[model samples]
Target: MSGEREPVSREESSTVAAVQEEAEAVALVPELLISDLLRYGVLLSLSLVTLGTLVTFLRHPDYLVSSEALQRLTAPHPVPHGLRDVVVGAMAARGQSFVMAGLLVMMAVPVMRVGLSLLIFRQQRDTVYVAITTAVLALLGLSFLLGAAE
Candidate 1:
């Protein structure tokens, strides 16, 4: 057998291109998933916030008529501080609680995205990104801890 390269064939090249396209499509799936995650997360957060505001206005119509009611609501209170409180309050149809939960959900979206990216990178065997994403996750956790301490 002659030690020479074979001539490129249209069929072979097209097969190679098809394989590359398939790989690209596979890569896009994760990106699309992440995109959808962010989109839906934000949308859900917005919806919750809107619903909460509507409920608040409906329940406390005085807020619409009086600045005092708005001021009172804006005043800091420690009732719905914990996760359990937020969940219970939200379940009980409390507007403020729903707003709190919505804000929490809004804050959580990016963190969730990062966590998802880490998983994707890990699955893809991308060590660099995995490490970076891990570091970012750790930093986010640290921020939450520090903020809680404040």
Candidate 2:
């Protein structure tokens, strides 16, 4: 044998290319999912805040019908709050509550991205990314816990 390989057929080459394309698409699933999640999250957050603003302005010609309420909303010093507070306020259908909830959703998106990444990496058997994403997610959780303590 002169080390010459067999002549490649066009059909065979196309089949191989198709398989490779399929694999590439499969690999992209995680990325696509994450991107879609982030996009939707931002949209949802924006809509919530917009709705809250409209509701507040309409309900209280001057935003909650009081300058104090507006000041509280725009205060430089963020009032330390909890999920329970947000939930309760939102349940009351208050504009401020919806705005706060929207902000909370915005803050949560990145954490959720990391978590979703870890899950996808694990599912795809990518050990390195899984470990890295897991650590990131853990750090995020720790920070939230520490922040709540303050």
Candidate 3:
């Protein structure tokens, strides 16, 4: 065979380019999803916190209690109890509960992103990444469980 190579047709070259572009787009889906999760999660959390603050100030213009009194009241129990209690209190228009819920939502965003990554890795049949992601998820779950037990 001669050392010279045959020129590829325009149609063939376009088809190859299209295939590459499609592959690149498919690969970007997970990244895009993660970005959206972070963006929307922060926005939602900020909205909740802002709404809660507005409602609190509107409902109690003079403040719920004196700053010193509030500090004394909360100093004994700095950390909140559980999600159920927070949700119930928030439903009752408790400003602190609303803030707590927003914080929880913010914390959950990264966990959700990790979960999505695990799913994407599994779908792509990437065994190494799937295992690593699973381990990370397991550690996260364990940390939550341990914290709750305390």
Candidate 4:
């Protein structure tokens, strides 16, 4: 037989192109998800903080107190222990609660990004990455548990 190749069929070429496109899209999912998570998290948190600040200024025009008084009022406090308390406090227009919620959301974004990574690694059957992601998740959980214990 001659060494020359036969002309490729259009259907076969189209199929190969489609498969390549799918592979490229699949490879981009994790990156896209991470970027979107970071973008949305920051945006949402900023919105919440801004809204809280506006509400505080509007509701309490005399909120501008002495530095010492402001420091005392904004002193570090433990997070609400229960969801109900947080939700109720936020609904009641508690500026601190809104700010706390925003901070919490900001913190959660990275954890969620890690979780998405773990899932993607698992789906791709990447054992090394899966193990690494799992360890990271474990450490994150441990930190939260230890912090809560304090």
Candidate 5:
């Protein structure tokens, strides 16, 4: 035989098969990790929020009245015509809009986290994902503080 060995057939190409499987396995790891993190984070966050909201309600249960309840209480069974406008106006201002907005953002933080997590998954980037995750958590906490103040 010549100094050079005989060329291998396609079936003998182990490097290509190993590389292909490694690539797929590598792609799967981050996606699985992200999904797990999001699920756990959401559960933990919701639990904490539920506890805090309950504690707050316990501390000041009077603020739990719905707008309709407030209206009904302010008016008799057959509300007086003149009083209807006043009741409506009062109901309109029942909740603090700014606080509500803050609360809404708080509620959306986990959702935003999911989106950012997916972005990270697609881009295979870590720095931005970690930074954004921290920011979302911080903002969510701030919103909770603002909401709790009301």
Candidate 6:
């Protein structure tokens, strides 16, 4: 306790700091490259599925109903029972169509994240930053998809 310690060299100090920073990043799952890859892939897949649904809607255009129109159609009416079924079906389809559209948009979020990751890596070659960015993109995309489904 009485003896003075020698000063750390600049190189040694910087290396130790770098190592500590890396260790902290390693402690977070989202700070790993594999995590980012998983997110990017999942988002891309969800978007594709959504796009497919949109295409199906396009092919079956006769059933599509805007929200305003659906509300109007669902209003109580003194119509034949069969006609009521038609209105109800249309209302359901309207919601499904919107959900599919939202999924498509959500998918784009992951793709955008991938691009940002690449840019970050190019600028600094830091895997932790890439992983974090990708993870964020994935979570946002998933949230969008889930919200849209509802």
- Clash totals in order: 0, 0, 0, 0, 0, 0
Whose TM-score is higher: candidate 4's or candidate 6's? 4
As a whole number from 0 to 100, the lDDT of residue 92 in candidate 1 is 91
- Which pairs clash in model 3? none
Whole-model lDDT values for every prediction: 0.89, 0.86, 0.85, 0.82, 0.57, 0.60
User: Over the stretch 1-150, how does candidate 4's per-residue lDDT look in tens digits?
Assistant: 233333446567888999999999988888998899889989998888787777777776667754665765678966686557767889998876787677778888899999988998999999999999999999999988887688
Model 1, 1-150: lDDT tens per residue?
Answer: 233434446568989999999999997988898999999999999999999989988998888789887666678865666678999988899897888888999999999999999989999999999999999999999988887688
Span of 10 residues, lowest total lDDT, candidate 4: 1-10
> Per-residue lDDT tens digits of candidate 2, residues 37-113?
99999999999999988877877786545778766668787652989988888888888789888898999999999
Alpha-carbon TM-score of each model against the true structure:
0.78, 0.76, 0.79, 0.77, 0.32, 0.31
- Which residue runs of candidate 2 sit more than 4 Å off their true CA positions? 1-21, 64-80
- Cα lDDT of candidate 1 equals 0.89
Error of 5 at 37 (Å): 4.1
Q: What are the per-residue Cα lDDT tens digits for candidate 3 across 1-150?
A: 233333446568889999999999998998898899899999999988888778777776666656875676567765666888889979999887887888889888889989999999999999999999999999999988999999
TM-score of 5: 0.32
Q: Cα lDDT of model 5 overall?
A: 0.57
Candidate number of the best lDDT: 1
Residue-by-residue lDDT tens digits, candidate 6, 43-134: 66576556556765776665485567556658986532233453453356644444444454455555665765656565677888778766
Residue-level error in angstroms, candidate 4, position 114: 0.7
Model 6 alpha-carbon drift over 4 Å, by segment: 1-8, 29-38, 65-150
Better of 3 and 6 by lDDT: 3
> In model 3, which runs have C-alpha deviations exceeding 4 angstroms?
1-21
What TM-score does candidate 6 reach? 0.31
lDDT of 4: 0.82
How large is the C-alpha RMSD of every model relative to the true structure?
5.8, 6.0, 5.5, 4.8, 13.7, 15.2
